[model samples]
Target: MDEDSSERRWEDMELDILVRIFKTFNIIELTSGISRVCSTWRLACSEPMLWKTLDLGLLKSNYIKIPAAPYVWVSDSSDKRLMRLLKVALGLSRGTITCLIFHYDLYLKDEHLIYTAERCPRLKQLVLPAWNQITKGGICKAIRIWQDLESMTMPSIVHPPYIMEEIGKSCKNFTELKLMGPCDVLFASTLATWLPKLKVLSLRCTVLTKEALILILDSMMHLEVLNISHCVLREVPEPPAPKRVLLELDETIIGKASRLREFYTCLEDSCLMSQRTKADEGLIRWYKYEEWLWRMDEVSSLSVAMEQHVEVGGGGSIVPS
Candidate 1:
């Protein structure tokens, strides 16, 4: 190397130039070591622009299936590791985070949710696909904290009224929702009652009843976009009769949905996603199928982006800036 080039130090670079360079690094790379190089680099790492969207889509919990209520036993080491990572990320973010994304397999506990809620006061969007360990109270508390929340992607719960009520009361700006499980009549009714003004909804790859679909279309007057792609639409019958699966939407449904700006549906037998949904009996067994399919959504805003993986030392622990 030339003497002049060797004499120049990275620390002498302008902060704006360093921040622009850091912007290209992924979450793992940013939290791994670049910040520790110098005080100036550390300042660049803490810049609000770099922390606005904290996407932990690649991080998943280490757990084993159990035959109990929770159905999975997450190791203490795994929980601690997640907590440590959250501490480092949230600490550097300094309450500037607006969007947060989590992997569908990353089962988070109440403490983790609460810790994140307390830090990300300005959070506007969240995509948390797994909620096996999260309790109703824990979710309500988080909702209360995230009053500015506008969009979410979550799994369906057993009883939906309580959470819907909480969201209605707290997140006035909330308009978009994506469900990763069946949407029964009760769930649809609860949404109509609480979030009637919801603008965008995605019930992709789930069981959706004909009555529920109609109710949503009729009730959500302000709905602008709806996605029922790859859904197993069914009609429940009276006593002594079995539910019948629907192959196509009748004129009634088509006419009502025509008013929406964007309505997505795929029920063709040749469609791979539709076949998968039927084979899995409405609830998709994501682990048994293609990984990308589970994260794909008809609504572009709800789709998960493909991220690059990077290997680091210290058992992959995320180091703070």
Candidate 2:
């Protein structure tokens, strides 16, 4: 056989075959490795199926806490690296990304958020856990651009009305939401006012007030699923009276939630998760515990898939170069 006939060129491979091979590659290899080999490989890397969900769940910022607004100070190098990763990933995605996932520690600035929003115009689901660096205006702007957004896993904010109103006004298809922090009266009331039609909500491992819980159960008549597993449920009496911690839901609360398709509540003191939530002051220190603990949710739609882990440079680590 002739030497040329015996040897096959990767460039000469079919696009379908290349795409199938590319499926095994993680975000790093797809962004930094194969795409630069040649124009054919570049075209394969740009395949729409390859860019549907950009999960940066492994990437985190190196930062220190400061006594100022946006209190955490992320290193300049970390910010630049994130920008580079976003530029490459979004450029190759070609606006086909429907779901975007970020690590709970990957704090992003206004510039990073807006840049992603502008590029991912078709984004339907977003799981962004940290809002320390992002401002209300910044998040609102991003939400407006994501007009098709259907679900989100976000950190609880001081003022929830702005973001809720933005989602209500922009995302008509919005149905699911998960808050990773304490839910107060204002936050619960804001959700009821702006997103009464919300279907699924998860306040797993967070502090949920009795008033907030009751308000949510009563107001969100269209709610199909509610998860408050491992939550620190509290009851506040009339002014001047101290708030009391409740170990279990009362008959009234349970009856009110009976109308929902799924209502998850775990208040057993023996349960490790329940203990952890109580010990940590309603916020589970996920890093110290199992990483999967934070991602666990009784509501299927609100849970993050563990399979989307991004491998960096042939290693198990998710550090992007």
Candidate 3:
């Protein structure tokens, strides 16, 4: 080894400069790399501040051989090793780690959850896909420890009563919430009542009936924005009213185009009532494609003739452009 060249390497990166370099790596990676460069480097890498924000997703593929899907993740020894590694990672720098993202399956045991709750006492934001994994008791326990929790994005929350009453009641500063997938009238209404101070609520691809929708709207009157995008809606069957109405409120408000200021389904089904023409007995052709368009054009003309602008029933607000 060239002593002169080796000594010169310290000019660019002294002990402090090397600690800064070591801080960029994760707890596991930094420990291994620094341990190789004699005992002194190992001591420097063990600095608690160097190991904040432990991202378990980064170590998903290589260390654990964990699959993206739950069904595919092999419940073998390697998986146990991965969980142990997570625990060790958490243990190494609990005080320093303010942010921890596990972009993988949370098939964690109860002890693990308790350990995690203990370690990440000040965890402010959490994003977990399977809320079912964490029970109402577990949630309450975690929140009891973590008073600083501000944001959470969980999918398919089964225990709303516990979360709304217990956890939310405890966490005074809690603001943002994003619950994804199917949620019924009961759950949504409960949330509106519980989280009165909630600023942002995102029901991801969740379906809501018109009646259920109204209940929510009335409850969350302070709501600034609402997103029901990509959500399903089952049409409510109603007794046929007058010959026609101007516009359908339900259709316009939730469905169809973006410029929808006022929403209702009034224009009628263009397909069912379409004109069918028969030129001769022998020819099986009904109406030409262009002929149907012409018929719709006539319907539009008739609708226009009835009312240049139809006033909504019960003196409701007029339609917007």
Return model 1's CA RMSD, one decimal.
Answer: 3.1
The residue-by-residue lDDT of candidate 2 on 1-321, one tens digit each, is 866666779999999999999988888787878888999999999999998989887443233333443344667766777788789889999999999988776788999999999999999989998878888889999999999999999997887888999999999999999999999899999999999999999999989999999999999999999999999999989989999899889999999999999999999999888999999899766666754556668888777766644433222332345
Tell me how far the alpha carbon of residue 266 in candidate 3 is from the true structure, in angstroms, after superposition: 21
Order the candidates by TM-score, highest first: 2, 1, 3
Model 3 agreement with the true structure over 201-272: per-residue lDDT tens digits: 555234444554555556665554444432333333466633221223454444332332221222233423
lDDT tens digits, residue span 1-321, model 1: 866666658988888899899988887667667866888888888999898889877543233333443355667777786787788788878999999987777788999999999999999999988888899999899999999999999998889999889989999999999999999999999999999989999999999999999999999999999999999999987868999999999999999999999999999999999999999899887766654566688899888775654433224444442
Q: Tell me the whole-model lDDT of each prediction, alpha carbons only.
A: 0.86, 0.86, 0.48
In model 1, what is the error at residue 293, expressed in angstroms? 3.0
Which residue pairs of candidate 3 clash? 248-264, 248-265, 248-266, 249-263, 249-264, 252-263, 252-264, 253-263
lDDT of 3: 0.48
Q: Model 2: which ten-residue window has the lowest total lDDT?
A: 310-319
